[model samples]
Target: MVRKNIIISSLFLGLVSASPLHLKRQDLPIDSYDESVAAGADSTDTPPVGDAVPQNVETFDSNTVAAEVVATVVDTPPAVAQASNDTPPDVIAVNLLKRSDMNVARADGPATSCIVRTFNGPQVSDPDTPGAFTSYPAFSTAAIDSVKAANVPSGYAAVPNFVNLNAVAQDKSYITYTSSKLTSYDPKKCAAICDATAGCTSFNIYYERVPLEISKATQVPDAALGCPGNADAASATLIKCAFYGMPLVATSAKSVYQYQGKAFKVVYAGSTAFTKSSGPTVDGLQGPVTFGDAAINAPAPVIDHGYLRTQTFGTNVPFAPELCAASCKAQTEYNAKHGTNKGQACIFFNAFVIYKNGKDGVFTCNYYGTPYGVSYAKNRGQWDDSGNHWTISNSFGYYVPGNYVAK
Candidate 1:
């Protein structure tokens, strides 16, 4: 057996929402790894103000779903940070290295850097009845492998990836009201489970921790507990998957339940896809998207070191900050060739993974769909405007066409 020792670091990114219950920056703890990657510099680290230009970029899979926006907190590392480094179940660890490697293959993979498998859900017209629990399908490596083809609608994209959430207390109204639980919960199959059930819309996948009691009947040895002579110890956690079609409204009775139990962590919260009459659109297609310089003011929602969106672009395309913008420019033409309704054209562009090589700090192009949201300059400032001076990095200057009409 090839023992794959997966090391999941506890690296979490913060999220800010446009909702009333906003996520503060402090709530989002920073990680050293992310900072190192963001801090890398290249030749165009800082471009002169007004020198940066927009470039064409490609589109990514997108849907204009309602923004419950739990902020799929991208976990930089896996949740199970065990000291013993025991090999986890193969199904759980295989997709842990979720992002597609630009260095190797570009075949179908997870939508985000986080790896969570999407499955072909049973197309039930309605969720199963209330008070009735359903079992998630058994784990199958073959079933997972079949869906690994690119550009196909595998209902998997509907699943959201959340990191480091606490387990839910069973007494919580939402959990109590949910009433459906599945043993051997797999986050990868969350989408299918929710869809198969009647009235089901959202679900939470989490690990449930239980305490070990060393009574006469249940003799847990010290070696097993990792605490010799300790009467009380916690047993290894069990993962539980809960499904709910109802919205977790912020009422007086419900809001408190969010923080109540040891089982309160949330691995993923999935909802129906974002709906839009038309697909994602570039808000402003400004031209001459420049490369490398210092900035007067940069836009919001910057992609400093996001995982490369696709393997083809990352491997075949040379490191060019303007590659995404160039892809965006040719989008209209691409759309003409491949039906605008198809939404195959690139909607957003980014240049990431900056590194220094001699005089120039080089970076590569990445494409994306409509982001959950975007930020422009405040107070009518077009610092993010085209031909404006927006800082890319300290060493080199690059700009992502910030304006987008996301779904």
Candidate 2:
């Protein structure tokens, strides 16, 4: 009986050892085991006792045993595991922390500052009222003579014809004027301004006495009691640079006037003028004769000789007649090479200034194959479809004289 009992105990122990209670090694797929090992889980390690499967993982079943086992065995936090589905856990945490810190920093910072400023307009002064001083403090006969001796500025030469008109207290036709109150008494500045103006051909520099205050008294013929004019009022001397469309002439300088008797004399002094003499000169071109305010309207030389083309210049380029002459010569040469008809050569050109709405607009050059006399200059101007009026002035004609053969 003892032998039989011992044998029974031995058989029971062998049966318990043969059939283990836990899952068999082969029951979990080899691929699942390998994946679990790849995810920081050792093949020899097992899930902690009583550990629940992550909520993000699918429910365990016979078909999904390997995947569920992998989710269970991998040492990952639930939140990190969920986030790892779309992005790396470390990257997600870092980006979220950075955005939160930036928001908090902006909320705690100071507000931005802004500023606005306003400016007042210029004051208008009257030229007729008298001020404190009786005469100009800066005026002297020697200074006037010195300015006359230095007739022209550095880049300009004296207009030999109008030298007699210098140092005269007269106002001529001017397109515009700049006061020395805005700048210094500089003739070079005036010349530069004239060079930049579209139709300015000359400039006049002068000193004029202006009153300091406006007269509030009643207008009376008697000069003693009431403010008749600013002649006797305290005055300020202003140097004026005036630009003109044409050269200075003796006829235009005869400006003489009196206001409220001669006690308050509005006098002018230290008057000087200048004109631009430097320009391009073309050979064999004749007659830059003044057409006054008209352009050439000539008939064709033959059937083939007539109007060629028109060119317009801007304010930067001065009214240069040689530019038109050069273009005419070029056109003649081009026709000699490429023209199909005989006598089809550009032999003449008209240079003028066009005024738009009574202001200088552009410098124009019109080319023609045939020559026209100044008497034939009949085109003043006309109106356009847009109702903008254009008129021509300061026109001059140039031509090749004595049988201009195209070669």
Candidate 3:
């Protein structure tokens, strides 16, 4: 794919309505990997600023990049309050690295790998019911075991690369949710749905306590007509599956308020989350290596060691690291032909999904001239006072092997 040069004049900004929730950054043990390269006085290592013009480059895939800049809009629940800060809002910022290179291969199909986990939680029930709502046994385990005991549904075979991420349903970046009345409580089925859905990378399956019917009145035969606010209205259990566009993390699976009203208190039980094991592969790149949940934070080998360019992809295009690889490769070729860089080329790149206000909105790729290891992957994300919460997920870095030998 060939792309036209994209001039990045200024950082794009947008507003989102959400309560402020800070996520602490996770620290990872670093392995000893020296990425130092000799720097000369003439080398330009300073990172690019807002005025920098970036070259729009093509990816290995035939998918066309969106022609216009895309803005992501987050859906806010009515029950949540808008964010408020005691101090002035922090400026939205992201650290960027210099140029890099990698070759990427087109993916054949949706990721086939998957994993599953079981969670022990309490079920929701009426206080006046025959039995009390107690701790639900390993809900996921029982569900999987029951499925195994019965005939396997056609096309619902286990995904080879599926892996479990958390014991609870993730509360972020959900596209939409449906109940067992529409589908089933089968993880395999949910995985299949995510595989087929564009931009869906993970899924959560659980049982939820919901009102049989919503009514405003206090006394009525059928909740469909009228039900009192006595809180004893009949409740039903729904096997719901929520799909997300990014990997699910246990940290975001916080079990707080699930949605409660005057007559009903919705609660979740036996939640489990699954994510894709890997990303698209480039032939020469050393990785699609996981950076845990952070972006690369490599120090400049030289003064000129900052990122060559940065590109953003909206949710319409699924997270594809190969696009970053291709952009890195393209930047190198452009530099060579123009005799711009003294002898440097793009040697590494980082790609990840960024969630805006709890929804997967942007897929970002940053190209670098110096290659760094996972130890440098420290920048997680930040919250902007604009009421937009930024979070990083499924971050990976790709690098070309060998030291930077300038041509």
Candidate 4:
């Protein structure tokens, strides 16, 4: 009877241990087993009596040392195997390198002094001062032709900024400005030409519409089909690029154009180089020009159209952004009485220009009739990484009208 009782107890213990294998079966890595079995290892189809059998298991008894060895061989968690195998090689290398001992450097230099100075265009011949305003050189017919001839098979001459053939005729007659037409049309190519030429600040390109049959055969999108006034691609009569010496003054004429047979309706007309000394002059303001508080969400001051202008009084005082602001305010008051554009009240003070020397760096305080606050400096002036020099740019400011007029 005691022997029978011992057998029964052993069976009961085995059954209790076997129940855990069934419970943990879901966590087994099936791929490992299939691969091991295919690789010709001996293992049972059924699980062991006391524990789950690992893939290609060599022995069944826990007392056997080989069984422990087999367990150790397949000890890797399934998730660990998957994660290690699926990761990209580069990602793995990055992680491994990150684990190694390495240090990163940071800037700890002293803050740069905000000194103010003035500069004029290097090529400007008038006033004999570096910062004084001068007339921009006009483009010659030969220069324009040189740009057109350089166009290759795969590039454009000028790109659309905001172009309209009708507007050009109505507001700014090409007759007033120096203009030359290209025998062929390419927006990027024209722009590249302007970029290459110094006097060629801005260029405009016009395209004639494509024929209806060609448009339908090309399967062009509706937007590219044409515009409202000039609705058909074929209706386009001309495709020409015109370079301007000054900012195209904004007129009461509407700013609209249509796709003749191209993707864009407006080719950019802004200049790559300085168009004029400052912006075009208009009436400043009527009555007392009170400098108001620096505006909130101030519109950035732009040149005549979208160009740059400034008066670089030869570098005298230490450069500071505030100095430029003060100078502009003073200039506005001066203009009110004796200035050429007397009514002009606002001015744009830009201190960020090319830094030349320690005491006499490039800076300017330009006067304008209107004070449009800067939205954001397109190129936040800073150190030029390529040139290894400190660069400054217009940060922000607004028109102060009727404020305590700087004496």
TM-score list, all predictions: 0.21, 0.38, 0.50, 0.20
Local accuracy by lDDT, each model: 0.24, 0.41, 0.44, 0.26
lDDT of 3 by residue, 192-266 (tens): 767666556666666555454432221112333343223565555556566665466555464533333354444
Could you give candidate 4's per-residue lDDT for residues 251-279 as a string of tens digits?
A: 21233333423432322111221112222
Flag the better candidate by lDDT, 1 or 2. Answer: 2
Candidate 3's TM-score = 0.50
Candidate 2: pairs in clash: 128-230, 130-233, 130-234, 131-233, 131-234, 132-234, 231-264, 232-264
Per-residue error for 220 in candidate 4, Å, reads: 36
Clashes of each: 59, 8, 27, 52
How are the candidates ranked when ordered by lDDT, highest leading?
3, 2, 4, 1
For model 4 the local lDDT of residue 11 reads 6
Against the correct fold, how does model 2 do in TM-score?
0.38
Candidate 3 runs further than 4 Å off: 1-134, 138-172, 180-184, 214-224, 227-230, 258-262, 282-287, 291-306, 309-318, 322-347, 353-364, 370-393, 399-407
Q: How many clashes does the backbone of model 2 have?
A: 8
